[model samples]
Target: MPDIALVLLAGAVAGTMNAIGGGGTFVALPALVAAGLPPVAANAASTVALAPGAVASAWVYRRELAPVGETSVSALTAISVTGGALGAVLLLVLPSASFGAAVPWLLAFATLVLAYGRRVSRALSTATGRSAEARMSSRAVLVAQFLLAVYGGYFGGAIGIMLLAVWSIGLGLDTAASNPMRIAQVSAVNLSATALFLVASDALRTPLVVATMLAGGVAGGIAGAHLARRLPARLLRGTILTIAVTMTVLYFLRGTRAG
Candidate 1:
């Protein structure tokens, strides 16, 4: 009921982040927290509110969906869903203090990956003399993706960036080629988590907040999809990097003060 406009705006930004490159939690979580929800509840609420936006982005990207090496798309989606559901359960079960303490570190790690993921990926490929066509086996990729999905379900500050990093570095995939897969995986992961939260958690009991955010997220996701094709790669990456850095610092500061 309070800061209704701000919540809607934040949701829109969050949706845009999902559409572009991720870090939506950087916006959605804080907005929920400011609205006075506990950290766990805020997180659950954010996942529920932002997932539809991610789904929207995935729809926009349906045409861009590229084949994942050795792994069927259905297999990948199933893995993501299962892992995400497990992770969401863990989030609900874990001690709040433990989650609070981990937030800053998680955000920092994700930001680092988002900031320099490509360079690190390229360097690894070069050191190994890997060819452009090199790819990890299906088994390996599925295992790695499952792990990332768990993390995405539990925290999800920059799941998209981490996925891109894994695909690029481990599979020798091109960034451009992997973007669609990244969106698809994120959509699967978050949607699974959202389904769990909505059914089991009280976070969505606040219907006004949830409704506004969902509407805004849909709008932003659609707009961002259109812009993603037109935006310069460097500029879009820079925008994501900037949001990640800012979020990392704020969450860290909040943790310190709370401690």
Candidate 2:
């Protein structure tokens, strides 16, 4: 009962975080691991469970979707789907030991990005002094999206933030204007990964856990989308950063103990 409650709470929190910005994986993945699933299985389950929430958030922002620079939304989504599928396949074929070893570092990297991504984006924009009209070519944006999608599929953490950073740096797009597209791309990546995980991974082994989390995720996602309109961006970002930092530290400690 306690475990079930924990998973449900984690899912709700994760869904809310993702809807607000990103870093949901920092919560969902560790909670599943604590629920006694293997790391790889937990990751697969997390991806599958959170997918619907992402879709819901995207739906809420549907009206605001726009082309990323010169790249059409459809083209970016197609690239995301393809890259995410490849990444999911890589997860399925890779040794579990490799994933276990990488988890801590992955969390650390994601935490760092979530913590300073915006600042870094601003710094880059100032350094480059390139106008949006002179932004990276559409082909370059597509390639960057593909790589980020691959990462999102394998172990998404702050994918939304990363996408925003890339688009900000490459296209000089404001975060407010580009956010709808970020949510849409995240939805694409998670949906693609979920499809592959459902067929090829053991994410469904604990059906009850998955179902509980999925339900919580949907509820939270819907609530979050509405809350996003009222919530201050600073407060939301601070809450997410706190969660990311704590999770990253805990994962590092867990790895140390295992080692």
Candidate 3:
């Protein structure tokens, strides 16, 4: 009962975090691992669990969804699904021990990206002296979207933020308008990978826990959208970052001990 409760709480927190900004993986992955799942399966299961929330958010934003410059939404969606499924397959095939070893580094890198990615984006534009408004070539957008989708499918933490960053710089799109499409793409990538997990991965090993988390995610996502406006965003974001940093440090320490 306690295990189930903890998983549910973690899922809710993760879902809320994702709905507001990003960093759900920092909470979801660790919770699952602590609940006795192997690192790889925990990852796959976490991906599966959070997918529905992404879809639900996308649905809420469906009417406002926009095309990516010259690239059709349909085309981008196809790329997202394909890449996401492939990435999920890769996760299932990788050795569990290997993923465990890499988990700390992965968390560390993701934290850095979450923290400084926006500053880096501005720096890139300054260095290149290219107006952020200049639309990217269609080929470039497609290729970049495809690669990000693959990463999103494999380990989706702050993927929505990354996509938003790309669109902002490459197309000069306002974040407000781009958010609908971002939600849609995040959903597409997640749902595609989720389909693979349901069919092939042992994500059902703890069906009760999975179901609890899934339910909590849906609830949190809905509540989060409402809270995003009412709550103090800086405080919320700072809390999430603190959790992420602590988790990364603990994971690295554990790895050192294991070594």
lDDT of each: 0.81, 0.81, 0.75
User: Can you give the lDDT of residue 174 in candidate 3?
Assistant: 52
Worst 10 residues of 2 by lDDT: 235-244
RMSD of each: 2.3, 2.9, 3.6
Q: What tens-digit string does per-residue lDDT give for candidate 2 at 162-234?
A: 7866776566666555666888898999999999999999999999999888988887777777777565666
Give the higher-lDDT candidate: 1 or 3.
1
Q: Candidate 2: where is the Cα deviation over 4 Å?
A: 96-129, 232-259
| Worst lDDT 10-window in candidate 1 | 168-177
Model 1 lDDT tens row, 1-259:
4678888999999998878777788899889888767778888999888888888888988988866777888999999999999889998888767766887887787677665666776786688787433647788889989998998888887788778766765666655556667888999999999989988887787788877888888888888877876777677667656766877898888888887
Candidate 3 RMSD computed on C-alpha atoms after optimal superposition onto the true structure:
3.6
Task: Report the CA-based lDDT of candidate 1 relative to the real structure.
Answer: 0.81
Candidate 2 at 128: error in angstroms? 6.1
Residue 221 lDDT, candidate 2, scale 0-100: 79
Kindly give the stretch of ten consecutive residues in candidate 3 with the minimal lDDT sum.
231-240
Highest TM-score model number: 1
